[model samples]
Target chain A: MRYLLLVYAAAEEAAALDTRLALELAERGGLLAAHELEPVTTATSVRVRGAATLVADGPFAETCERLGGVYVVDLESLDEAIAVAARLPAARDGVVEIRPVVRREG
Target chain B: MSSVATVFREEFGRSVAVLARTLGDLDLAEDAVQDAFATAVERWPRDGAPANPGAWILATARNRAIDRIRRDRTLAGKRELLARLEREAPPAPADDDALPDERLALVFACCHPALAVDAQVALTLRLLGGLTTEEVARAFLVPEATMAQRLVRAKKKVRAAGIPIRVPPPEALPDRLRAVHATLYLVFNQGYGPPPRDELCDEAIRLTRLLAVLLPDEPETLGLAALTLLHDARRAARLDAHGDLVLLEDQDRSLWDEARIAEGRRLLDRALALCRPGPYQVQAAIASLHSDPEPDRRRIAALYDRLAELAPSPVVELNRAVAVALAEGPSTGLALLDALAEELDGYHLLHAARADLLRRLDRPGEAGEAYRRALALAPSEPERRFLAGRLHELPNGG
Candidate 1:
């Protein structure tokens, strides 16, 4: 099954990574699959009321940087998934958040 | 073991590769090939060798595997694996054509992206190039145990992931090929760099030749070969009788290997003609320019500029800055280093570069400080000595 590998970095550190390198890594891609996201500060959130939709100020948490990017990868085991996660460039500087994606029930 | 069987066991990896791809089960094919060798040891001497030793072995292994599959608990899976094996031509080791074709698959297999970068190099050296793990480890300056672990982990990952044995699809091949190129170049660097001076250079050259043969038309492969030759051509001039480094300009150009330089330059010209610029090609171009009787500083500087543009990093910048120092002047290079020093504080070469520029500018005290910093950050004894020598040469001997 494929799982999402989410990268989170310190805001300052993320800003420090050379754009050329980061973009090259994104373009070169990796074995499973991955993509880099814009910085977390630009994120928006939403909430629901009985008959109205409400927008929040930002992402679920307030931190230096959050959800730097996500990689969806097909792996054989959780150990393998963790291994792949650990190798990500961001993993050297930040936390790599791994979560199983729930399939939609039709 | 019979002499013939011993020879085959010594050099039967290509056989295993063909069997593995044909069988579509790397582990099982490995086992079957081993069993075939065992049978060969028992029969080759008595039978005076079959009309075709490879055919005899293949037929025997195929029959043995079929027999085992008939009794296997996972009959369906075994049957599928066996069917895949049947798709490949039976081993014909005596036939040059069959051996090269099978070995070609093995080369691609060794370069599988599923393998970790380190594993790809280690495994390629082991299986395809017939190198021991110790030899491979020594080439990379890593502990043998660590190299073994890397190889084991990579193969385990491949098996666990069920990585297909076939070459990657066309769309995916470029990245996969890059990984392979990087691995080869890494191994080559371990040989090219002046130090340890072990016989690993021979092994590296052998591996590159194999890669060139397997990837006949790849300009990058040729570029890699050229890079190795050009870099190695200057090996004799890099050190003095006491093993101290002799800076390029001070070294005796007569010590350079002319034949290797000529070959490397020719290959580099062809690679550049292809117009597909890559990191290796750029590096080869730099090496080629340096090999000339009167290396054009402008050409060398321009090549480094392109290299920095292609793969911009503090390391590239530092190298290019050296060329810039040569082509332009110390002041221009010093300005560039001054700007980059903060970002590359922890990097040894940065301090070394700064120290060099400071020395040229007659700022001996600052140069001494930079040299010391570089000595502290250096990973090897030789580099530390080089830095220390620079510091000792300061006017006040700081």
Candidate 2:
């Protein structure tokens, strides 16, 4: 099973670089991809309605926490994904949303 | 009444547990088991019970599951898995004896912390306890439809989220075990209280016994089993002939189940020997003290003190105050209870305990006011009646 861990945290909290944990996850033989996004200030939101493409200056939706990073990891079960999520540094200061990746056959 | 019915009652959880492991799908396993039971109900009476009824049920359920898998169009993608399952040799027929105990796995999955506590309780009762949705709803005082919805949503989450159906690794056992223990304790408490329902208590004890067997070395598991047994041993004496509440001091100790008390004591001793006293162990120790013919209130107070340290909750403090009153005096207990006034203002038992202390201290006016407050917050008819009786006995007829 592959899970996408969407890391969300406050801007200031996200600034704290903890690349060591990401390396640890990769060494654990599960991490497929990891990337820290630019700040929400640098994000541009785009929406496609039936006829128009509406562009906004900020992220999609304003919440207490902003999307800070993402990690796609292959794990045995959701429990394993949750274990990884709990270890994320952002999990202490914010939230890590774990969603099962939908696989489409070629 | 029939042997088939008896087998269904006893082997339902075990069969479902085994089938779920074999099929790798909880819902499919349950449906298959239900179908097998229905077949038994239809055939057993006419043909006489099979020599090994459980094996018959398991084989029948497996065949039905395979048939359904092959026929269902939506399961086309899963044809390979189904074919592989069918190709494997059937489990050896040993009646109910040879079935691997997959119930512990099912129980852990049902009580996963990711689910709401109520949902965990509801799922455990429905799946592991062999309770119908309506029965669970009735036990929890919820609408049947509400419970049905809750079960559907919880099952969906179990499938969609891929919650592993297995006991957690030993290192992660403590936290996961706590959730399982808490759910069982909640079930036990529900039946241990006013308007008591013995069935729920029995189910809880049964489930805890299963957990104890599965995790024999876990001290907390043993502690919980001991705690439930000790509390349940006194069930007969918990209420009077007229169905009113009986205080522990006034209850007929002769009515207590000595066998269960002895068993509970053994479990508690074993748990304490591990020297890893968690909340359940402390509570079992307290119950052990209370079970004594001449309960050592001082030791009970000390146990409560330990319990408060382990699990710092207002309820523990309330219990500790009662123990202090028993060991020391009403004044000392009253002081402790007063300190908790702000935190436990909404809790009816706090006022009731305070009222008892005041009544003992000869403060009729204060006791009357406290009793009234307790009555106002009291949720159950028996408790309200008990408070009213106490209030009426006050000096000024309050």
What residue runs in model 2 are displaced by over 4 Å at the alpha carbon?
Answer: A11-18, A24-29, A43-55, A103-106
Best model per lDDT: 2
Worst 10-residue lDDT window for candidate 2 chain B reads B75-84
Enumerate residue pairs that collide in model 2: none
Docking class of 1: incorrect
Q: Tell me how many clashing residue pairs each candidate has.
A: 1, 0
Q: Candidate 1 lDDT, tens digit per residue, B1-398?
A: 23654456334666566665665445555566667778878877787777666666666666666666666775446656666656655556567445434655565666776566777877777665656678778877789999888877766555544455666666656776777777767777766565744455555665665666677667787788788888888888888887777888888999999998998888778777887888888898888888777989998999999998988998898888888998999989999888888899999989999899999999999999999999999887777888898899899996
Each prediction's TM-score against the native? 0.71, 0.93
Q: What DockQ score does model 1 reach against the true complex?
A: 0.05
* Number of the top-ranking candidate, with TM-score as the measure: 2
What fraction of the native interface does candidate 1 get right in terms of contacts?
A: 0.00
Displacement of residue B47 (Cα, Å) in model 2 is: 1.6
lDDT of each: 0.71, 0.86
Off by over 4 Å in 1: A1-106, B1-13, B28-76, B91-94, B100-108, B138-146, B197-200
Q: Score the docking of each candidate (DockQ).
A: 0.05, 0.44
